[model samples]
Target: MASMSDHELYPIGDAARRSGLSVSAVRFYADAGLIEPTRLNEAGHRMYDIQAIARLELVRTLRELDTDLAEIRRLLDGGTTLHDLLTTHLGIVERQERTLRARRAVLRTLIKQGGTTAQADLMHKLVSMTDEERERTIDDFWTEVGANLDVPDGFVDRLRAMRPVLPADPTAAQLEAWIELADLVSDPAFRGAVRTYLRDTYAAPEARTLATEPFQEFMHGSGAALMEELLAAHRAGESPLSGRVQRTVTLFLEAVTALSGTPLTAEARDRMADGYRQIPGILRQLDEEDAAAGGPGYGDTHGRYLALVAAINGTTGQEHDPIPYVWIADAMQAVQPA
Candidate 1:
């Protein structure tokens, strides 16, 4: 064979220069099976054909598109099975393009308005809470609770009923509610309150005691009825300071004692008597004060109290029903210093 110049059959380093790639890069591509040298020289150094140099250029182009090395190898190996990979890459590119377009739209709006830092901050917040992101946040909270508690029967249904579902177009109040609710659930104090409530219901020996069953039934049934009656009186313009109010209160207390398995012991009755003595003086004071001079009417005040109670109790009458009394108590306790 005739002796050829270095240009005719260059070594790996020269091939790299011709291909506009580093020698190390050429070796990596060869090792990755994207390209191979045509022959080896006397010292067993790689000798590349011109065609191999062309293949290196092609590999560099594919890599610039972010194609994986394994996929590159398949393309080089005559694998015509790259349709799925190309489709996936195209979808990703399309999504990125969409995001950029949205960002540009926001910037344009800001520019036209002579944007402030507040607008920029609002944009950041909104972008952070994509629909998918919000759903994942809610799902994560439930998932964590699911791992810890056997969700009581009807609890999930109640949650679905009471939970605020922010509209596709949410108002500022709704957004504020969501932020507060999220914060409440994430707080250790709130969690501790929830744990305590759950423990009281499910773990306490007293809760299972026969004496407690009657009390529970009374609270859920008769006590609820008494509350309804008192509410009705307030609604009817009856003075809560009147003798009628005292009579109703006495009857309600009697009902409680009757419903409880153990009647009020002598000591308890004595304590109750002491409390009763103080009530008449309070009622007299309330009588002397004008109804219009106080805060909201009794009915309105009671309604607000009931709403808070309902939220704490997790009771739901309608979608996004008011908070229960128990929840209000728990939340209040959580916020109180030990």
Candidate 2:
């Protein structure tokens, strides 16, 4: 604790040299209000005491570490401690590293996609969306695709289950699948196809609510029988239109009619076949995209939705493996009267 009068002061040039900073750099920091001098020399030159020398050294070190000027100013003003600033800086650095890693992942996806600039741009957007924003994308999709349609019981819950929640640190493959899924849902043709399928599946709001119970009943009863007959036919090497196949197809169509509470006319059955056909195609497309991106295939949304609906209707054991819907539809078509 030297007396005020005994404390030595150095001019800016000497201070800069002692701190290993250039004179211009010292002037810049002083002018930026980052460093304050103890007094001005008679000629109006800046003069700093020992405390200022220590502060200037710290300022220079912080600048070397690329700390923001405002942050440094706060630190010097005693508004924040060095530990606080460093902790915040570490968070910023980590976020920057995450962004760089995401960019690298996007580059790899672009290369795998054959360097398509449009796809690269799309992938970049996918990676950049915040979690809330990504969730909104799914909401928007369901809104557009399910518009004015008769959604089954717990439809929203099923949609939520199918939602893609991208990980905070997504891999290249995950990003790629995200981009593809975003593209698929954004397509007008895709939306229209899903809309028509949904409309045909549940023709009215009343039917939508009633669909789960009868559907579960059919699935548990006649649906199981049809599947057994089909499997038996497959094992016997019989064509889908063979007498045995036609019998089971008739039984299946009758079961569908009973569930619908409507006449099982030719046109109605055609619509049913077409509706079932749409889902497997969509599922196949997602599966192909996931495979190309090296992702585990899209989680089984089609089956899961069905299972959820059955569960809500108090149906269990519906998880038993059964004949593919497409195979059933094809057999139904094959057995249709000329």
Candidate 3:
């Protein structure tokens, strides 16, 4: 149906020149089925009509955009839409960008912290966790702590609620906090402390004596009473060695006695007071955890747990103020055995 002029076709060289591509590129596209030549001259040369010239230009443009030949062919054949291709590629680009950003932050933080290998390893581990992975880390800690124990209903949920949900784009400080928290939860000493708290709170049925009530009620009463007393002492600036502050040791002992479901003897009181001496040490650990977490956000998950347990057990001593604990212990030691 072509007239003589209409059948005029460009050779591969002319087509490549018009499309700003090399002759080899045009030949490659043709061989790749991306370009269908209008005809083959008798001399065995590929010839392109106006339509073929336009297709060659499209192939050249797609190649410049980094589109693979097969994908370009799919686009040209209308087998795939430009929108779908770009959308899928865009998602991939965004994810790569996010990963790059995280890596950038990790390196930056590592350098600022003196570029130590240990720091780099730790930060890299923290950076590798996805949001879900971070959540699982917290869950795993609680799981380990709660294993083989009669954890009260809602206790694990409360602990989960305290978990810090690290931001998708975290700051250096947040990263530091996350790193510290992750390390803390993995510590054997920390896990043992948590287990000890759980054991004391939920005394095993076989181990139960007449000295204790239900764990929750005891925790609430003991926590409320101890907190009220300590916060008042804290507010009043009472010296731990003062007689007035020391006398409150009896109140503390009574609360412990009420929970233990046993008679409050001088020896039992002394042992309980000895246990209270550990409060200052534990508080020091919590303070370190808090400091690492950049001073509290999800309220220091470990700190919250310890504070709750301490309050319930009537040993709510401030980390920096060991006076109350010292006073209580001294007072208990002074009491004569009947």
User: Against the hidden reference, what TM-scores do the models get?
Assistant: 0.32, 0.40, 0.41
Candidate 1 structure quality by residue, lDDT tens digits, 1-338: 54454346679998899888899999987786678887888999999877788788877776777888878887778774557667877888877765564455446555765778887565445434676765665555444443455334444233333333445544333344444454445555554445434433444453343225455556557766665665555556565555554455455556655664445454444444454455556545644452545433322322332343344334425333222323222222222111
Over 271-293, each residue of candidate 3 has an lDDT whose tens digit, in order, gives 87786677688668856775785
CA lDDT of each prediction against the hidden true structure: 0.55, 0.70, 0.67
| Lowest summed lDDT window (length 10), candidate 1 | 329-338
Top-scoring candidate (lDDT): 2
CA displacement after TM-score superposition, residue 44 of candidate 1 (Å): 2.4
Residue 35, model 1: Cα distance from true site in angstroms = 2.0
Q: How accurate is candidate 2 locally (lDDT)?
A: 0.70
Candidate 3 TM-score to native? 0.41
Q: In candidate 1, residue 201 scores what lDDT?
A: 40
Worst 10 residues of 2 by lDDT: 296-305
